[model samples]
Target: MGRAGDVAVGVVFGGSRVDDGQIAARQFLLELWHRDQQRLARVLLFHRLPITLEEMALQISMARRSRLAFLSALIACWFGASAFTYQLALPGRKLVFPTDHYSHPDFKTEWWYYTGHLTSASGKPYGYQVTFFRFGLRDKQDVKSQPLFTDLYMAHFALSDIAAKKFTFRERIQRGIGDKAGAATDRYLVWNENWRVSGAGNDHRIVVSDRGTALDLNLKSRKAPALHGDNGHSQKGEGEGRASYYYSLTRLQTDGELTVAGKTEKVSGLSWMDHEFGSNQLRDDQVGWDWFSLQLDNNSEVMLYMMRRKDGSIDLHSSGTLIDKNGATKHLTKQDYRIEVRERWKSPKSGAHYPIKWRVAIPSESVELEITPAFAEQELITNRSTRVTYWEGAVQVAGTARGAPIKGKGYVEMTGYAGKLNI
Candidate 1:
């Protein structure tokens, strides 16, 4: 349904100005642009244009600098101004698996996020995060002259060596040139460079390798998917389009191999996966968010996110979801819970102060948690791709539920602390 039709037409009529390669290439850029993937759309467009062999070298040099300069300005124009043209995440959205697990081109932004805390056979603890993002540039039908696909694909992989108190992360961005990166729409598969995540049924595999760290894990969901908010229509703000279709597989049994410093070890643990998509989510007044995905020892999971305003108050739209052991979900509004910062840590690299310790409580549910980080420094400086600095780290949760002592591991994400999170 993409460039295949254009390719067939060009081949049947023989090569011309609108040959198969030209049509396909243009469509590729158009698709990216249409989806609001402006940087990649412009990068590939600059690279794919015809150039004489003599001038190719010069053009390449110029293109490199131009692309860099253009991308540097991306923070000002990241998601295109086509929010009205794209489909918004309104209420009453239905989510079908296999299809929804892949990519959503109609929406402006989508992400497949996985994070877990693992323990090696030797008793060493580890934490990891692998996420794939699809950013749409423009609508496909907008390309009138040539078939163009203007979408950008980005992925981030991180591993935390809790014992060593070290965290490593890598970020990548691709224009899908020559099939180097892409996401399958019919199935659960997303990849960039050598990193990939593929799934069938409730079983998923994550493979990521970079520098001296690698993670190869197989995750099988132990419970049904938990729909967040009103039937997965998660509201981020009071505006019409400030929402998203959000769901999570909060408890997945994980097992596989992880390589650190050239040493591979067998590991097993529980993972949490969050998939959300929509055209617009954060409102203009919202600056950032603090998100927690906790998997308690009691087989229960809690997903909470607080959207923070410039005045340091939690937005009214902040909410959460409680996934019971039976896989049933209960929505929690802003007033249902409280998050008190017990301690804060400042990052030396970014000079941003982030709360590393939190006192979290849901009085109605009788769940109280003291969230502490495995390490104080797990910040990700993603200047290469997303161009945002944020903290995503393994956390230890200790507290009580219904008067019963409980403890577990989870992940906490704090954004806008390093800088204003644009997307």
Candidate 2:
């Protein structure tokens, strides 16, 4: 992709060389041209040449150029790679009330991801996950098409239905770098023709569907936004830049219809949302993670996460929060939580082991909860866009808090264990 984008960037550069001294074009368009050429020059230029130790210094000095004037050339080198597809960058320190919210672009990747718990009118439980991801290709030169309306968006929508002691999962992928297919501007909604998740004010709507399974739903949020880490400075690892602007709508009131096996039924349940975007989302040594969002009987919500590293150690930055039924939030650190796997179930389809039973303990308040899947076959298979498989389902909750029978409903995300997440 870099070679292709470089060829395109090169042509723009060639054209700019012809009009070299035109001040009006040089200041704006020519600069955009130079910035883009410098980006492509980093990769394509070095590939065809040999650099001496002194040339290395010159290459390092490229950062003195405007393209990377904001950050160091060494660090900016990674951002210039082919990994960048599309980008929206903003500079700031903290999130303002209601303003620092919503999707952020400057970060490497951002997604409006939704996975939920549902029950059909016939009393059958179901699960669904629909995600829209945004990636930053920092340099304007990363544009693959001068056609402006070219495709720049990617989406994945999936559905899982559990009934009659069986489960079914379906997924769809969307590629619409077009303005109409996946247009995003002014904080309004955007989608690839159909699979959509967007909002204006307090009302939001999302829809993802196909023949075997579908989601035609309306979600009205009750709880306000909950920021993760220090005002959206959620860290991914010990590294300085390995963090993201992350937050979640712990609980959203869901009333919608789901279709399974050519049958559509009206359903209502609780949905959870996570919105995060950053550059280089994962750490080099981080293996995968187990994330859970449980709504307790006490109207409190507990979100726990454990980042598995290659050395089998847990990353301390892998922590979540406690949101009361009233929507107030309390942050949780390394000392307050523990997740113990009691039994493992291997997916017959993917041949991966997933801990079916978990003993979740939060030592801060001396609480222990046992999470059992509503059924053993809650595993999901995506035929559309995910290009991956995992288990996402409703679970029966049983636990004791202060020796009282406490019941809760929640969702758990088991990744990396199945296979390293593509992201």
Candidate 3:
């Protein structure tokens, strides 16, 4: 199948010295069409390509009647390819608040992620994660008359019952059909069915319920959104469009009701929220990444991601950010920090070996930390929704900052361990 896709792409570009934009557009179109030809044709075409049928037929040598049919099909494919170009993530994009928080339909992919630690009045410890993802199925112009097939929405809800040594999760996926599932461009509202995250002016609410478990949380941001890597342009690999407009609300005061097994409890804790959008962020050689979001007891935070390649080496584009107690942020290059794996765990279901413990150090900041998962089995096999298997879990942190003893809690996400990630 992949060989066939390569051949199709080559045929499309064989006649012309196509530039980067044209190559990307044709490749994307071919991928969608190859995946589902019937659905792609119906959902992705509203306008025709500007080429004339007579001119197209003139370029080919065939019988008069057969020439017309061939040209018609060729034109349809070209129109579909040319009309579905998405805006790339590039430098110099000035990200604004509240507005940037909304959905970006021009980009190919976008996600809003939240993770935190909560404690009940009785001192019971818990952890939670909620993430909403939007994947563009067609360009904005092509979807004006057919809004339902414009995008795909997915959501994931997870709870870590630390005391019980149990982890539970649910996932939902839906198309942009009517009000059943959608993300608002005019506000910070995104939903897949009843699971949703909505906000206004830095105050947000998250709600999700399924299989006798639910979470209803209200979050208030304590600091401004921290822009990452060159003012929100986070480069993932070497290239013009291999980056993302990324930012994080590292600290949020969270209070909410968590219900598990028909028992509801009021909880309070600190949370971290990340919002990122991009067209093409990963290269073909890149496999996946290890992402960390740490909120320390000193009211400071750190975010780091290490992109791993197929050759078992870390990509030079891997980087991080440090948010000080005052919410000021500093970007860290690949050389600014070091991470060493300390332990590994093998998942019984997926048979994927994962790094579950690590030692992280930032020498310039006089910081060093040892991170370990609260429990080892917080992996999710989401066959029902995104169909991606990964481990995302709450972790415990203990270390030294500026020669002082400090402890913290955070979340770690490791992907592509089960298999090569398609995105």
Choose the strongest candidate by TM-score.
Answer: 1
* Per-model CA lDDT versus the true structure: 0.78, 0.62, 0.82
Candidate 3 lDDT over 22-90, as tens digits, reads 657656654543454343333223222222334334444455426345434543444443456788999
RMSD of 3: 10.6
Q: 240-321 in candidate 2: lDDT tens per residue?
A: 5677777788777898888877788999988888777676557778877788878777867788888888887898888888
Q: Please provide, for model 1 over 45-111, each residue's C-alpha lDDT reduced to its tens digit, 9 standing for 90 to 100.
A: 3443221122333434665545434432431132233332678999987887766787776688889
Model 3 lDDT-worst window of ten: 1-10
> Candidate 1: deviation at residue 315, Å?
0.6
User: Candidate 2, residue 287: CA error in Å?
Assistant: 1.1
| Model 3 lDDT, residue 56, Cα | 37
Worst 10 residues of 2 by lDDT: 1-10
* Residue 145 in model 3: lDDT: 24
User: Which residue segments of model 1 deviate by more than 4 Å?
Assistant: 1-84, 139-149
Task: List candidate 3 stretches off by more than 4 Å.
Answer: 1-81, 139-148
